[model samples]
Structure formats: C-alpha cells, structure tokens
Target: MECIKCKKEIPDESVFCMYCGKKQAPAVHGVKKRGNGQGTVYKMPSGTWAAEITLGYYMQDGKRKRKKSRKYGFRTKKEAVEYIATLKQSPKKEKFITMFQLWELFQTKKETLSKSKRTAYNIAWKKIHAEIEYRQIDELTVPELQAITDKYGTSYYTKRDIKNLLSHLYQIAIRDDYTDKNRAQFIQLPELQSQEREVMTKQEIELLWNDYQKEPSAITAQMLTMLYTGIRPGELLTIKVENINLDEQYMIGGIKTTKGKNRKIIIPDKIKPLLSWLMETGKKGLIAYYPSDVEFYDAWKQKRSQLNIRDVITPYCCRHTYITRLTTLKVSPAMLQELAGHEDYDTTLEYTHLSIAERLQEVNRLD
Candidate 1:
C-alpha cells in the first residue's frame, strides 16, 4: 500500500506509515500495528482489561532501550486508556518491585523495634511473604488483603501481628505515594477466646517457693516478687533497688499510668529477707535484674518450664493469688485495692476467689 501523504510504499501490516507518520487504513486482516511510545491495550485472561506503556529506559553501553510497564485488571478499556494517560503525565514512576522487596526496603528505613518484637515481626514477615511475595504492593485491593489475613487469622497473636505489619507496610506505601489508601486498615482481627486464668493452689505455691529457695536466679526473684507484691509483670520490670526501703520495710512507686500506686507498700517479713539478699547483689537499677530488663516475662517463662511444676499458672495469676490470699485474711477492700495496684475497686473484686473449704470454714466460724 502507498502512504497518501509521502507517496511512499508502506508495509501492508503497518497502522501508521513509517516514512510519513500518517495513519493507514486497516488491512483486510483487520490487524493494526502499534507505534513507538504509544501504548498497547489488551484483555487479560482473567477477563479484565490491561494497559502497557513504553517508559524511558536505563542507559547502558551505547544503545537506547525501551522499558515497557504494565497496569493490570482495569474493568474497562476506557479505564485502561485513562491509566496510560495518567502514566504519561507522570515524569517518572517508581520502578515496579515485588511486595517482599518493598518490605526489605522498609526494614532498612524504619526505626528499630525491641529485640523480641523484631524477632516476632521477622516471623510474621516470612509468613506473609510466603503467601503474597509475588504480588505487587501498590495494586493490592482490600478484599485481597482481607483474604490474606483471614487465611492466617486462626491464631490470635499471629492475627494481631499480621494486621500490624500490614498497616506498617501500607503506611510506608502511602507515604511514598505507591498507594492512596491502606487496604490493610479495614481488616479486623478475629475475636480471641476468653480463656480463664488458673490461679496457683496452696500446694502449688509451696512447691514454687521451695524451688525458688532451692535454686535462685533472677527469674526466681521476679516470679516470687510478682506472687508477694501482686505487681503486674510489666511493672516488676521497672523495679529499682532504690524503690525498696529496708528502713521503712516498704516499696515505693512502680505502677504505670499514674503515680497514685507510688504509696509505700509495707514489705511482708516473709519476702523481706529475699528482697534484702537481692538488694545485697547491689544492682544499680532494677531489683528484678535481667541482662535485658524488657524481657522479664520471657526469662520468667523459660524458668517456669525448667521447673516443670504440675500446674502451670501464668505470671498474672500471681496477682490473682495475692488478691485471693488477702481476701481470705479479711483485709480491708480499699486497702486491698491499693495493695493490688488496681485502678478500680471493682477490678480488685474480680481477683478475689473463695474456695469451698474456705467458705465452709467461714460458715462454721459464724456458728
């Protein structure tokens, strides 16, 4: 065929005449040839329209190369055209990378997390990558994100971690303008089961105390402190040698939130000797001393496993047992609340549990 403008012979398959840059009529086969810098639009196998454009390329030895970029899953051909138009307007788009690569970049740029927390995030990251590493982070939809989370939502802790990690990733994405909204934000974690905490029995407590007396470590001191003081495990991490007053035989503030629980708690004669021995260790800070103060619970957990007591109670149950013992002794409710470091009087009430034997003993005493 001849180009009408240039009077030059054009290839039968060409949509635009190469010599004159004029649009040619469609060949008998109805196929059109695409030109340079002009993008291609096609229907994907998944029944969605897609568009691609040749963006400027990286410079090599001496050759000009074209880099073709694609945007996927547009519902309509018009949408694909608009997408290409948007790409054309952009001076340069961020190079397309897998979600896992973005995560690696994210790790490098973000501030550090605590050691254990970093370990947990790494675990979560590996699990997430195994599921969706091949997928592009920028193009992820809400349903796609929800599906990923829902698949691993069986474990409560894991679900929380996945949501947190996803939010972090999307926050980075939004900051970099890779995405407009954090699709992970709308993913709700499944409701956790309300498993009741089991408090230590008198026999179990005796066993633990005897073990502590037999083989003492920082872990032993932390557990015994929780049992005696009813301090939250976290609050115990903040205990300093200065917080203990041997002269007054009381402890000062370690409670979080407010300074109200900073009152002098009369040190029981029972645990005072142990506290004195620990104080004699002369640790500058944190009486419940571990090399890593933040990992108190982990050390305590490892110690508990080593001891292998018959009934395994959580560290929080130490607070429960303390409150129960105080109730058994008929201590003042207001005083008990203060001792337990409870913010509410009602919260203190929930900790007190009277056994059948104790109730019967009380009834007999009433007669």
Candidate 2:
C-alpha cells in the first residue's frame, strides 16, 4: 500500500505512514486518522534544526508560494530526528499558532494556583519560554520537551515538572487547534526515573563511595550528601557553607516546599569526609561548584560513564537509595517525613518502595 500524504510505499500491515507519520487507510478496519501533509526535517536559518511541512499555499502579488509551517529550537541532531518523526505521525492544525503566541494564551487562560505552585509554574516557564519562543506549536513533541531538562542537564525533578507543564500546554494546544494530540502522555522520563531505580545495591553504594573518594570534587560531594541524607541535588546545590552546622552535626537548607525550608538534617558520619574535603577547598559558594547547569550535568554524566555505572543509576537515584536505607532501619513514617523534608505524608509514601525481605520481616514480627 502507499501512504496517501507522502506517496511512500508502506507494508500491508502498517498502521501509520513511516515517512509522514500519518495514520494509514485501513485494509478493512482500524484507520484512526491521516496526516495533513508530508514534512521534511531540515536545518533552519537560525542554525537550528526544524521540520518544514507545508501549511497550505498562499497567493501574494499574483504568485502562489508554499506557506511553510515549521517547528524549531531543538538543541541536538538526535532530538531533531526523533521530533520530526513524531510530527510526521500527527497531523498539523489548519489554523496555526506560534509557540510564543500559545504561551501567552496559556498564561491568560490558566486558572489560579497556590503561591508555591504559582511560583513553580513561573520558574519552569522561564526556561520553557527561552527554548520555545522561536518555535511553532506544530513541532513540539512530548518526548522532546520531557527531555528538555536532560538536554540542558537540569535535575530530574525539574524534568518531571517540565513534563507536567508540557502536558498542560498540549491540552490547551489540542483544544485551540494547535495540534491533534497531547504528545506529552507518550513521553518516558530519563532511564533511571522511568526504570524506577528506587534502591541501590550494596555494591552500587560502595562504588559511589569509592568514586567520590577518587575525585573529591564538588559534584561528588553533592552525590555523597544525597546518598547519605536523601536531599535532592537541586536542594543540595542551594546549601551555603553557613548552612553547615558542624557543632550541631547537621546542615540547614532545603527550599522546595514550606516544610522543606530550613529543614535541618543530621550529617551522616559516612558523608562527613566529603563535607570536610569541601570545607577545606575554601570555596565560598554552592558546594557543587560548576559555573553553569550545563557544566554540572556534563561533569556528572562524564563521571558516571567513567565509573561504568552510568547505564543503571543516576545522581538523583541516590536520594531514593537513602530513603530505602532509612526504611530498612525501621524509621517511623512521621520522622522519615520530617527528615526527608517532605511536606505531605503521601509524598513520603512514594519513597517507601520496600523490599520483599523487608516486608516479610515486618510481617513476621506480628506472629
């Protein structure tokens, strides 16, 4: 069979057009939809990659020129490839909108949120706006935007937040004739997250500990702190030297939520060597002292690959490992909540992904 939009040959069993991404006409049944036109992924004049698809031709000065519709602002070749593939599968809207215009409409249409939520939404969009300002709604894909944090090397939690924001925007986009479906739903987070690496093996723990010893760098310090304390790396970066209470044997900083703020956690003896090394360095700012977010992530990914553990775990997974260890020690839920700086008890439950042995042991105590 041939795909109607691209005139490309397709297998008899194919459900969607490979070159165009539009749904195929069913042999007997199962045709969901078809793409409006075939799109080509190419380099834009801005030196960025884009998918150039016709938005329908327009006549000007008695001459008809193809009205080009494009999606822009991808940061890498791999992203551009995957993105244009998705655009081919979905049909573009007849009435088009630029991402900048859509963002404005979103701001006006959004209902009120809590102060913290409002602040969070504002902060997230600042990054989103920078990337999407020049692009069009036609080009954005859920997987591409979900990886936005990873592309820029921001935290996984921030990636989750970005995914949420994109999902919300796609909803509005679908409603306003910006696109056909919410691509955000199809996006899987980074490997460690999507795989749900909730706990680290003792071998993995030992590797992380030894790896930090070898480098004794700021990024390693943050990693060790998170492994021992269950603090998010983003929160760990905000901690100043003054927050280190050596006399009290704890640190005081965590700013994600109301309860998380000023959350003092006792420094584990295991992580103190890292803290001591950081203190000796005479650095006056963030402990994880990369010049920018990109460098921080770059350093981490490089080190992870060097450690030969990059495939299975990530720095954020250390926070989950900490929670799992505490749960093994039979830490009470309320105290765990306070120690973990979680605002809601329910949020704490997500971290309590316990093991079979742990569950069996706890259950046997009753008998």
Candidate 3:
C-alpha cells in the first residue's frame, strides 16, 4: 500500500498512512471503533477491562472541557461493553448524595456520641427528612434549608436541632468531596423569643389546693404532683407507677438529656397523698396514661379551665412554681440544680420565676 497524500510506502493492513497519517481509502475488516464522545472499552495491562463515557461539558479556563466518567475492574470485555451501552442509553445522572445519605454517614462516623445526643439527632432528622431526605445536599441552598427548618420546627429547641443536623450533614459532605462549601454554615437561626416566665401565684396555689380538695380526682392529683415535684409535663406522662417510691419519697424518671434522664424526683410531702392516689388508680401502668403529649396537655388545659385557673398558667408553670418555691425557701444552688435535673446551675436559676414584687421585697430587706 502507498500513503494517499505523501505517496510513501506503508503496510498493507494499515488503517492510516504511517508517514502522512491520512486515512486509507479501503476500510479495515472485522474491526469497529466507537464514534467520538460515545465512549470507549479497552483491555488494561492487568488483564481487566475498562469502560468510559462522556457525561457532559463545561467551560473552564476560557476553554471548553468535556466531563467524562470511567469504571474499571470489569473481568470481561463483554461486561465492559454492556456497562458502557447502559450508560449511553440512560440520561446522564450527576453524583447526587442526599441529606439522608449524609446522615447515615454521619451516624457511622460518630461512634462516641452519647445515647441521648444520638436520640436527639434522630428526632431532629425526622422533622425535615421527608422534604429533603432524597435531595442532594450539594444542591440545597441556605435559604432552602432554612425554609424547611422554619416550616417543620415547632419551637426554638426544635429549630436549633434542625440547624445542628444540617450543619453536621454539610460537614460530612464537604469532607467527602460531595461539596466544596457548607451552605448550612451560612444559615441563621432566629433568636430565642424572650417571654416573661410565669409561675403559679400563691393565690393560684391556694386555688389548686382548694379545687383538688373539692374534687379529689386523679387528674387533680396529677397536676398537684407536677406542681410539687417539678416533674416536666412530658416526664409526668412517662412515669411508671413502679417508679414511685411512697416510703422513700422519690421516683426514678426523667428523659431528653443526660442530666435529665433517670434522675430521682423527690415526692414532696404536699404531693405524697396525690401520688399514692394516682398509683392506686392507674394500677401499675403509666401514672398518667394519655397516648401522646398533645392528649395529656389537652387534659391539663381542660383541668385548668374546669378549675377556673388563670389563662396564662400553662402546665409548665407547675414546674416553674415548684422551682420558685424552692428558691424562696433558700435552697442551695447545688441542691436546686440536682433536684431540677438541670445540667447547668444557670438553667436552675432560669426555672425560678420569682415575681418582681418578691424580688423588690428581698432588695428592700437589704436596706
């Protein structure tokens, strides 16, 4: 054979001229070449096969760049060919890593996390998982995540949890090259709303005692138990009858955090009769068995309305009243912190909702 352009001698089986690099007029037999950008399958030095495909293109450095993906370690050329064929037929898909996937990764890497903290993360993820669990974390913007957090979050604590979850997921995504930036870092959580803490007034406490004396029902007992013991409304519902120690004057029940979990709550002399009555009535089951927190709260609301108590007095105010009483009695800060199951002394102080008049009375005593 002769080179078509240069008229130089070349091998007869050549597909292109050796000297001029021009295509021969007659095509080669029994050999096929993939078209440009269609992708390629070839044998490797290790005797495995590889397949590659052009995914898309982008402009970089003032030049057009072709983005391609490759897969190696195929044992046979046929497997490589089939794989590349599937890639060519399907629409090009980006490497999408969902927020839920990142969550799984985060959980796997965080082995030393406390059980309570892990539970908190599970709860926080559940709030927004349905909306963005399947969406790629890299595609999510700060505003989008913020909107999701705002929509699903019910309280300052819940919103904080959602923000913390997002921040953690973004951390994993950035570390693994899924994304270069953590958009969660840019998200701003709204400040916690400051409201005047309300506790049951002395008059209100007299009213509850009078009302309970009149009725003497289990519901009345339930309210008085929380009022005297400072048991959280949620914790009150979760208490088992067996956990109540009438002779010992304490019960083992709390939840939500390390400091708050399984802590002993003292059964005050004021509420001991109420607790005993509740134990006998509930009969070894949950002391206050309303299926959910909402139901229990609704019952509390009904009880309040029936008793004609102040509208501002929520169930939480019962716990507040207990703490305020302890503070007024000059309980040491250390004892208050332990009794209230507060991790911080400051948190125990926050629970004491002393009236301005009471504060002024103490201030005047100093003079």
Candidate 4:
C-alpha cells in the first residue's frame, strides 16, 4: 500500500504509513471462527472468501507472527471503512507548554540580571503572574498584556516594567526555540510626567520647626533628616541606625535612589541636634522611624487642620525647603548638585523654586 499524499510505501495490513504517518485504506474482509475457537479473518475483494490464513497473522522469516489488529474487530464492513477514513482526516495534536514552565524559564534568566533589574522584573512578574498562572504559554495574547497596561493606567513606568518582563520571557522562549518571535517587541509605553519639586517657604519652614519644638518626637527627627539631607521620605523611612555616622555627621548607607541606585548623603547642621538625640537614645539596630509616606501624609493633613494652616505642606516640602534655603544662601549649582546627589544640574535647579515676590522683584529690576 502507498500513502495518498506522500506516496510512501506501507504494509497492506497497516492502518498508518511508518514514513508519512498517513492512514491506509481499510481491508474489505469478514471475520470467521476457527475450529480451535479463535477468530480468523482475511481481506477479500467485494465478497466473502474461504481462507486458511487469519487476518492477524503475517508471514515473516518463514514464521507466522500473530498480532491483535484493531481494524479486524469492526462488526460491520461499513463501520471499519468509516473508522479508517476518519483516522486519515484527523489532524495531529500539537504539544502545549504551560505557564509554570515559562515562569521557570523566567526565573532562571532573571538570576543573571542586576539587583535593580531583578526588582523590576519581580514586580512585573507578580502583576502578570496573578492573571496567567493557570494558562498555557500559547494562550497568552497581546490583548491580555494590553489589558494589564490599561488596568495600571497612566503610570508608564509600571507598564514599561511589565513589558520588560514579557520581553525577557519571550527572549528565553526564543533562545530555547519554543517561540520564533517576541510578541512584546512593539509595545509602546505612555509618557510620564516628571515629579515637580515643591519647595516650602521660609515662613512654612519656621512654622514646621516651631511646631516640631512643641512635639519634639520621632516625627521631628524624620522631618529634620528630610530638611537637612534632601532625601526622599521613602529612602528616609528605610534608614537604619548603623547607616548613620554621628562622628562624621553623615548618613553613610542604606539610602537608595528612586532609580534603585544606592548612595550616601551628608547631614547638615540643622539636623545635627536631632541626629545626636536619636543616637543618644541608644536605639541599637533599626532607626527610630515612624509610619511610611502614606501614613505620614495622613498625619501631616491632620496636623495642618489642627494648626489652621491654609498652605499645602507635605513631608517632601522639607526637601523643597532645604533646596530653597540652599539657593537663598547662594550655594553654587555644582555644590547643590553634589549635595542632592542629582545627576543633572537642571534637576537641582527645579528644586530651587523662587517665591512670587522674588520673581516680581527680579522682573521689576529688568523694567
């Protein structure tokens, strides 16, 4: 027998060809009962036939090899023909890789990434993995990834992180020959607004410092650190006691930038007394810290309400206050850049917001 499509040679009794895997034509035969009670069958063209050879036996090496053939078991000749025709038309099932397998690949590749990269990858993985953990790799579509970006909204940084994770996963798949192309290659991230630095006024600073004197607690120390060092509230909250150097008057370690880079900052004179008090209190390992940024913001709101202060003041306002004070003291832009650990001088300048009166005075001078 020969395969219809590939014309590969196959045994007359065989249902599928060994070379092309194509199903062969069914045998036109009927079953017969042997004297020994075993069933004997033979392929006969168009009619019934008397035969000594059983359909199951094939002569090989001058020996009769008896095999249990399923094609011979069909009750009717029509059913046997239909079964063979169905087998010929059926498509082969393709293997599907699970999401768990893809995640394992993601983890192995993520180990080679930098600390910052690993953090971003982990964050993105957590977000996507929540939805697709039970889905197959082939089941993941572009629309599902786009939905994730839509859910996160205009925070393009998070969307970029998610896209980056997908890109890495696709790269792993390509390297392993699991996929021919990366689907996430063409995803566009939305433009994010740069955070505007809001500097507090001298009067606002005086009000906060005076209010701190009245309370003189851990919050006061936290506020002082922000004002003196120009460190972000998130960075300050994570500060440990060991990271500070009272003798050198500096925060030596445990301060991470928004971009996830680590750096040291010099503590100014304004926070010197506050740092001294915190150190003298003998808190061994962890710094005496209060709540997080969100918590602090809530407390700040309540404090504002109590003080009857109409101005908007945030914990970050301390950083603004410090930058404004530096500009007022006529500190060089280079020195400000160094103190703020800013890569760009323009970023340091943004922190130096001049008052409306000062702006008017400069304009009047030009007139």
Best by lDDT: 3
Which residue pairs in candidate 2 collide?
Answer: 20-88, 21-88, 21-89
Give residue 215's lDDT in candidate 3 (0 to 100): 74
**Could you give candidate 3's per-residue lDDT for residues 126-147 as a string of tens digits?**
8788777666776677889889
**Candidates ranked by TM-score, best first?**
1, 3, 4, 2
Backbone clashes per model, in order?
0, 3, 0, 0
RMSD of 3: 12.7
Candidate 4, after superposition: displacement of residue 314 in Å?
6.8
Q: Which residue pairs show collisions in model 3?
A: none
In order of appearance, the predictions have TM-scores of: 0.64, 0.50, 0.56, 0.55
- Flag regions of model 1 displaced more than 4 Å: 1-123, 126-135, 139-154, 259-266, 280-284, 289-295, 310-312, 363-367
**In model 1, what is the error at residue 211, expressed in angstroms?**
1.6
TM-score of 2: 0.50
Task: Tell me the tens digit of each residue's lDDT in model 2 across 54-152.
Answer: 554433565545656556887655566566566644555445655556667677655464333444556677877766654566666655665665564
Highest TM-score model number: 1
Off by over 4 Å in 2: 1-197, 282-284, 364-366
Give each prediction's root-mean-square deviation over alpha carbons: 12.5, 19.4, 12.7, 17.6
